[model samples]
Target: MENDKKVIALAVRATRRREQLGGLVLVAPAVVFLLLIFVAPIALFAWRSVDNAEAWSALPRTRAVLRAWDGTGGPPEPAAAALVADVNSLDRSVAATLARRLNYSESGMRSMVIALHGLSLSLQKPVLEQLIALNPRWGEHRIWQVIDNESGRLTPYYLLRALDLQLRDGGLTKASDQDGTFRVIFARTFWISGIVTLLCLIVGFPVAYVLATAKGWLGRLLFIAVLLPFWTSVLVRTMSWILLLQQNGILNRFLIDHHLISAPLTLIYNRTGVYIAMVHVLLPFFVLPLYGVMLKVDRAQIWAAASLGARPLAVFRHSYLPQVMPGIVAGLVLVFVTAIGFYITPVLVGGGGDQMVSYFVAFYTNSSVNWGMAAALGTLLLIATFVCLGAFRRVMGTAAVSGR
Candidate 1:
């Protein structure tokens, strides 16, 4: 009997292992695809936020010597030889990358580095003296201070700049008011996203409720109309709005012809246009999830409350809001997070004052070739999104529990 039991147990174990192996095989492709497309890119973004390999890699000798010496006026005598060796060994392309990094601290630095490379052909005197002669800026304590601050492989410089601060005198300090560009952008991004989310909720919740509760054929037709926007491309929709909202465009022309206004309103290329375009695009995101949740709600309870002499507003506030709270939270998060990272809609419609963090991120990434700043901004935006979503969820959850 004991032998028979052991054989049964062995059979069960074998069967379980085969099932687990099959499940792994089925899941492997999806896991690999997600990691490659989503996880890998996000990891690279976060890594780039702190990665300062170019600084130490370009100035290996300088980094070594500077470790023991205190960061006072300037680096010691060997620092000059170390710098000369570092620059002489680098090709123009490599020197250009290092120059670009240095130029973040001091303008006109790329030209100086390029010129020094040109001077490398005629090294009559020490390269250090040549560097100073090439540009007096190279002899300044501030220039050396920038290099010393950026000697580490991993640095908080990108992150600091993202937050409108900088590392100076071995500690973090407020960057120049002029350099405090990012924080203002961050504030504007969140503020715009908040307004967009609120606008969407004001419009979407009623639309979702009506659609979810409407009668058969008309309901289906309305649903299709709601979903029609999804079929068209976002760019097309945005451009269409521009054509309609521009001065003397369809909307303004109609209003003028009808004598509703004396002149065309300043619509497109302003905050008004940004709000209109974004709300139009993002309304579906807020509505669909909420509509799905609303479909699952027990209409019987709402009617039961009404039958018991509950007012319409009371039925909605007391009976309706609690059940649909999850969907509302989901919709809010989806819209707000999406809105904060908006680029195309805002860029196409918004004025300079209305530009968000994404505009600068794209600028740093594509035009300026400043990946560090771009990565830092993107990562910080991601963190802010998560933090806001978490806080919203918590507050909504608490309200839900207490209301019930």
Candidate 2:
């Protein structure tokens, strides 16, 4: 009998080990997928922000002209010769295009273009004359200054601009010049996400509590309804909101018919629209976590508190609130992080003023062709999200430890 029991225990141990191995094998596919899609692209994009030098392609010209050239306008003759050869080789028309592209690499890049164009004219007048027609100012040293600055392999020009900083006179400084700076966009993004998180908590907490206390089949049905949003497309939901919130849409028509307001409310294509859509999309995230924690909560604890002469509100505030705080923190972190990266919902339902950081990220990547700025902005968002998640965990951990 003892031998049979030992054999049974060994079989169980082996089965557990096999299960662990199977789980590890299952995780491998996901790791590979992430490495190929998310990790590789992100790394490449981030690298572009700091990689400025065309060291291999234009090495001779770069070495010649830039050898004696400082950050100021006057580049050496050899550097000019190297640049002319490099530019002229890439395409006689490429000098101007390269100038524009490299300008993102360094400030005051116009001088480098001018310097290069002048050198091209001196070396090969026919090519320079044709190019010079496009921009007569190409003869000045300002263009060369731009070129010389950006000749390095790894550059911070795009990354710095993404953070509202610019390289001016060989140093990084804040860019207060334009209203559409990175700092402005970043701050607005943070504010919008924070507000959305607050809205979700304010609305979802009560709903979750009601769902948690519901009895029998009703509880299961209600919980399923709460989670139904997950099965639908976010874009579909966002578009639905746009249709419903428009001037002549169902919501406005109903309000107008009921004489709630004399005129059609400007609900769609505004910040309010953004808030409504975001809250709706994020509600499930808040509810699910709260409900999960609430399921594990002891109903008898509240009863015991009431029996100890605690009022209903006091029992709720002291016992119920603390018990569900972990869920609240988890839900808030998830929603806020997800909301910060929201693009399609905000774009479809929201106006220009309601664009989030993700919109700017897409703008820089697609429209502006500014990969550095895009990568830098994405990196900042990633860092912020991670920090928020970590803080949430810490807060929940401390609360749990103290609750004991």
Candidate 3:
């Protein structure tokens, strides 16, 4: 009987192990799919922001020597000699590539480097003299510093430039006012996103409440109206706004005919247009999530609070607000995150100053062909989103604990 019991136990263990193995086998394909399609691409793009291989591609020996130097005085003779030898060995194409990389940090290096290749016949001259002879500007400390900064296997060049800073010998330096508009643009992006989120919350809270509590045909009709925008393309919605908001558009015409205004307003191609378009598009995002949460709310608690002699506002604050706060915070975060990444709507409706980080991101990717710059900007934007998400989570946690 004992032997029979042991045999039965062994069989059960085998069956359980087989089931577990089968479950893992079934999930393996999906895991691999997400890894390849989602994780790999994002990791590669983020890596591009720190990629600096092109900096010393044609001058490896010189970069190696520069990397070891203390960087106080002139670049070591070995580095200078290496530069001369490398320039002579490589063709103009390779030389031009390195020159372009260096010029990203400081201007004039392109012409100087391309010119140096033409003048490098002397293998006998002193290292500094040979380089100085080739180009007098090469003798400057700034030039050597630029080369040394770019000598690393990885760099902060793209990331720093995105923040409107430059890596220099003394440490990070603020970019000159003319070239340092990224910080202002970043601030503007946040400012616009905040306004849009606030507007969506104010408009959507009442609408979502109405939908959640409405009866029969009224509820269905309101739901259909809310979902209507999602069915239409974002571009179509934006163009519709353009047709309505442009000078002499429907809005101005209606107002003019009614004698509400004497003249057309400066609406399009400004901050006002951006706000109108963004609020309209984002209102649904705020409403739907809050609506779902509100549907789950027990109306009895609201009635119970009122019956306890609490005023209407007190009932709302103690009963209804606590229950729906999670959804409200979530919707606010979602709207803000979506608004900051907006590209087409802002570009179509807003003025030059109203353009956000996404505008510059597209510029770097498409027009300037600067993938590193684009990647850095995108990475920063992503970090901002994550930070906002963290803040939302914290607020929700505190609210849950305090019941406020």
TM-score order, best first, reads 3, 1, 2
Error of 2 at 36 (Å): 2.6
TM-score for each predicted model, relative to the true structure: 0.91, 0.82, 0.92
For 167-213, candidate 1 gives per-residue lDDT tens digits of: 77777788754566888899999999999999999999999999998
What would the per-residue lDDT of candidate 3 be over residues 1-404, giving only the tens digit for each residue? 99999999999999999999999999999999999999899888888899987764777888888878888987677877777777777788888888888888888898887777866355676878766876798788888888888877888988998899997775989865436688888999999999999999999999999999899999999999999999998899999999999998999999999999999998999999999999999999899988988999988999898888999999989899988987788688779999999999999999999999999999999998888899899888888888877777686775532223
Q: Is candidate 1 or candidate 2 better by lDDT?
A: 1
In terms of lDDT, the best-performing candidate is 3
Worst 10 residues of 2 by lDDT: 122-131
Best TM-score among the predictions, by candidate number: 3
Model 1 score (lDDT): 0.86
Go through the candidates in order and give each one's C-alpha lDDT.
0.86, 0.76, 0.87
How close to the true structure is residue 368 of candidate 1, measured as C-alpha lDDT? Answer: 88
For candidate 1, the 10 contiguous residues with the lowest summed lDDT are 395-404
